[model samples]
Target: MSSAQPEDGLPVRRVITADSFRALKFKLSGARPAAAPADPVSLPQPPAPQVLPQERPVLAVPVEPPAEPETVAHEPPAPLDVPEEEPPAELIVENAVAAMPEAAEPAEAEPPAEAARPEPAPEPVPETAPVVAPEPPRVEAQSSVPNAGTTAASSPSAGFIERRVVERPQPEDPEAGKRAHALLDIMAMPTVGSLPQERALANDTLLRLIPRMPLKSLRHLAERVCVMESPSQLLVRRLINDSRIEVSGPLLEQAMTVDDSDLIAVAASNNPAKLKLMARRRIISPALSEALIRSNHVETLLNLLRNPGAAFSIESMWRLTRIAAGHPVLQAPLVTRHDTPSPIAFQLFWQLPSELRRYVLSRFLTDSETISKILTMNAESDGAPRKHADHSLLSELEVTAPGEAGAIYAELAHVGRETGDRIAEDQGGEALTVALKAAGLTRAQFGAIADKRADAEALKAIFDTLSFNKARVLLTYWDWAARRTGPYARIAAA
Candidate 1:
């Protein structure tokens, strides 16, 4: 064993035996010393507790006491012996094996007395109990019935399921018609005297109510409101043109306030009935009659002609006469009209039916000279010459004086006779024109030549060569002749 010293060390350590060195080494390593064996006589003993063999063993966990400066001895806790809650019966049966601790000796265990008490029996239900339905809601009665006039049949009831009885309203009193008429009278009065706006409103109200009124009421209202003196021109005009003949008749016949322009416009409509009604007015202006005539309404023209108060211009009369030719219904009125021009009357005479022709002949053709003139004029204008020439009569006339007049008459007479049955085949236009000019004869005399000849072709030739004025006269005559003979006559002649 040796001892050694290191630098900065003041003392040297001595080496010991191996056992002692090992013991010291172990002490330096901070390890616990080995426990010594206990002496049997010094050991303490615990008291014994008795337990049943079949009982389950209890498992307890040991707990250590907390450290304290002053240590006190604590007695081991007495066995708790507090009874544990028993598990539910169902659980006991289901887990009887698992819930119980195993015993050392299985032969010592006891069998369960009975299977788990049978589950409690369920309560029984009765079969005779009646099923009660819920009661319906009650409605309170109304204190009083509502007035028939105040309640409407169409009004909704208060509740969705509730029913209501509605009474019908009473009819109006019997004097309702009289009351309505009186009201209408009151409304119509303002249409004349009130402001224009008020008048318009009154007129509108009257019109709205008029359609609902009876025929008698409408007539009465129309008579009172549609007069010329009234200020309601709009109402009067509406009434005048109303589609109802009764409503418009009075206004058309006597509405003096109707403007001439309005009358003309109505005439321009060519509504024969309305125009005829207007023609019956107390006084129709020439302009109005002219417009009426221009409409070419046959009945209207007849009405105007029959209206003594209506006057016509010469041109209008001529126009009316031309129109009257196609309308046999217009002939009688035309003939009877005092205002009708002599020429127009004469012209219409040929178009009159055979019965009316007598009156025309007697009235217009009083003398032989006038008869000759009319017949001659008619023939010339008609462009219808005779088929056979009467040259014997011409030869009987003495041309005592060889003057231009006598010479022209003789030449025209000769040419007319030459244009006999074969005149239509002959080119007599130039000859007829030369003869007429040389004769210095009027259109009447020229027409007579063509008429006497009985050749339409020759007449047309003569007409073509005549002056514009003479040709027009001939055209008018031809038109009259065509009408005088029926359409079949023209077709047959053709």
Candidate 2:
């Protein structure tokens, strides 16, 4: 130990151990003394914070204060000392990077490398590329004439043309029959599952061949074609008026393709057989019946009357009755028609056979006596003169011969009857008037004489000469008689 002097000039003496000297030296150097190790059991722990009754304290204690946590100024961590490895031979580059000057300023503007090196010119593109479109379907060109399958040199019956594709006939080809047969064979080919195009092709081929086919072959073809489910209208129409009955018969009977106009044309033609076939069709229009009536073909008209499917206008029925009146065969069928008009039925009643007449009477409520009276009236009224009678003379005769008038009329009527001269029975208008006036005949008496005399005109003349009241009574009776007879009778009476 050594004594030391204080700055106040006071001498101080102190004894120092080695430990104290080491501690002093460390203190001056600002170094803390290392703490000695303590026993684990002896180490004092801090007091625990207060815990709420409801909460349990966790085992992990927080290291920092929540309110103002202690933040240590941390120094950056030292870089890891990783061992360096030698560069691979492939990664080594021949050109070394040039060292930049430490004090060098960056250049204000650098020229673009793209401007220095000219850009490669764009490659030219062709304007059009090869585009493939689907090809249109090929339809074989047809010749003007349709007999291409046959030739002038070929025989008419060219043995069944196995593979004949009849497109269109050339004008030079004369064997039209052979071409028709070939086209028919193609159409007859089993079309059960054939494509629409194939059926259409066959149809087009047949249509073209039809006009070119000879008459005989066309007729035979028509018979077969008419039986098809749906035959072409054009083909059926062409065959409908064919001059030969064989050709037109099947078409008229079976073809639905024949329009009413075509049927009418056929009916109008001078072919009874064709018209007869038309009458036998499944259905007939009123227009067709009229056309057949105009044809005046008895057999055709008869057939039309018999066909249950035939429709007739009132006019047509009347015309049929008029024509049928002379035909015994037509009368039976016309009477059987349920649609026969009442007037026509009455007209037919007179012509029908006894058995059919009973049938007609059963259908209508016509009075036979009334009809007879009408006939009598019509027979009398026809061609009767309209000469005015001397009404003044009638009055004078009534005054002079009132009692003898009845006897005179009876004698005159008897004499006229014996001579078989209706004109004598009628006498003159003046004489008939005078007799009627002198007799002062009642309506019933006048009607009986008029009907018996068969002279309605004479009755009219007598009526004209009578007094207005007497004439009215007679006129009413005559009107009733006319109504019972017929429409014409009624008009005449009026």
Candidate 3:
């Protein structure tokens, strides 16, 4: 090693090879060598710092991503097929012969290379398998699924499907059963691998493996997992977070029945991780929430009209509708708008009695257009759709001392929406026709809808059939009044 301070007062150090050290041994004595400079460079400012752009960040405008460093070459990994050790040719030939005795026998006259060739040709045996098997249908999918043996044709009939549940005897030796179960559990798990739909089979295998399984196995636990879904989600967080998660399905249903917002909020909280956990895991479906909301909705009156026998209550609707009133996801449900209740809502409100209807209508029906529409509809169409009611039930029930009447056109039409009490659809018209028909009220009994729709002349005749007093009021006074009020005033009167 040679180190020295030269003319510029710069110290430099040199490491010499063994040859150079031996040659310099005679000239240099045992004096202490000078220390190398902290930073050695040809130029005083340093050799441009090797211009490593990576070490120093760019001083320009900040961009989304910084520039990358230059890449250094790397060696590729060795091929996987390459074995750690190569067998001797003789040993390989010996093994090859042993593996394919038939092939070796066939080509015994030639070198083993020819025999190896014949052996490898057997790879095409799979393709030629059909010719050998003679019955392709009997061996379908044998190559891929590898002997499933299960077949649609061989499947047992309805008798097998109708078999009742049966119990099996448990192993008497509990310890032996436990070990067997544990061993079988490991083996079966590898095949099933936590697949979504393999649960039943996996559970069956699990029970079989643990021969000491309870008579009902995990049936109760399984049923609870599926059925005890939370309705409120408020208690769900607390319940699932606890070490002992014991709760009934009906209770969970009650909990989940609340608004989704409350559910999401409760789930978001740390204390109630269960709801959030279920949401994350997707165990609770979106459809379930939607169905629950729908179940609570008002349901269009038309549907009720079509199927009068189908009576559905909307009790839970209050909480669900109030909470999810503004959520866009709740649009499909027949819930009234949060800001402006819909026509059906108004109808429901109006059904609350004269005083309540008047108050609600006055408070919320502030929109003149809406009010005008409602009032006009109340006059022209009454309650029934314009078209259907005008022809079918409208004229018959229109004069029913106000409240006793069936749906009438004048009750629901308004503004430019002269849709009348007309059925929005012919099916609705057909439904009304069917109902009237089913009621056994014919054209003669209820009068033709056309007769009801007729000008003053036809309606006058209908008045003639009923009591003179009621008919007179309906005929002359009602007719004159309907005309005098400009149709709008008649609804106001009602």
Query: Cα lDDT for residue 476, model 2?
Result: 26
In the predicted model 1, the residue pairs found to clash are 380-447, 385-454, 385-455, 386-453, 386-454, 387-454, 408-439
Best by TM-score: 2
* Top-scoring candidate (lDDT): 2
How many Å off is the CA of 217 in candidate 1? 1.7
lDDT of 1 at 164: 49
Per-residue C-alpha lDDT of model 2 across residues 108-218, encoded as one tens digit per residue: 111111111143422222222223345687533333444654453265554443444444454533476676667566655666856667766766776666656666777
Candidate 2 residue 139 C-alpha distance from true site, Å: 39
Which tens-of-lDDT digit does each residue in 1-494 have in candidate 3?
23356798544544232222222322232333334345332112211112222222211222233222222113232223223464222333333334433422211111111122222221111111111223345532222233434453355441222223344657655354345344334434543465534644544444454334332332233233334333113323323333332332222333344445544343333233233233222223443333333433333222211222222233323334343334434332333333333333332331233333333323443333554455346446435332322344444564555433323433322112122222222222222232343233445654454354434343334323333122112222222333444432333234
Task: Give the alpha carbon lDDT tens digit for every residue of 1-494 in model 1.
Answer: 22244686433433232223223323543444444235322223221122334334322222333332221123232222223453222222224234334432111111112222244322222222222345687654442345434233344573433344543544434443354456445555644465666655655765555545565656666676554354467666766766677877777887788889877877777777888888889898889988887877666777788889997876777677777778878788888777765456555654666456445433542234554466557556657642333444344344433233343333333333222212223233333443343335555555665565556455545444454333223333333343445232332233
lDDT of each: 0.51, 0.53, 0.32
TM-score for candidate 2: 0.38
* Cα TM-score of candidate 3: 0.22
Alpha-carbon deviation at 312 in model 1, angstroms: 1.4
The local distance difference test score of model 2 is 0.53
Q: CA lDDT of 134 in candidate 2?
A: 52
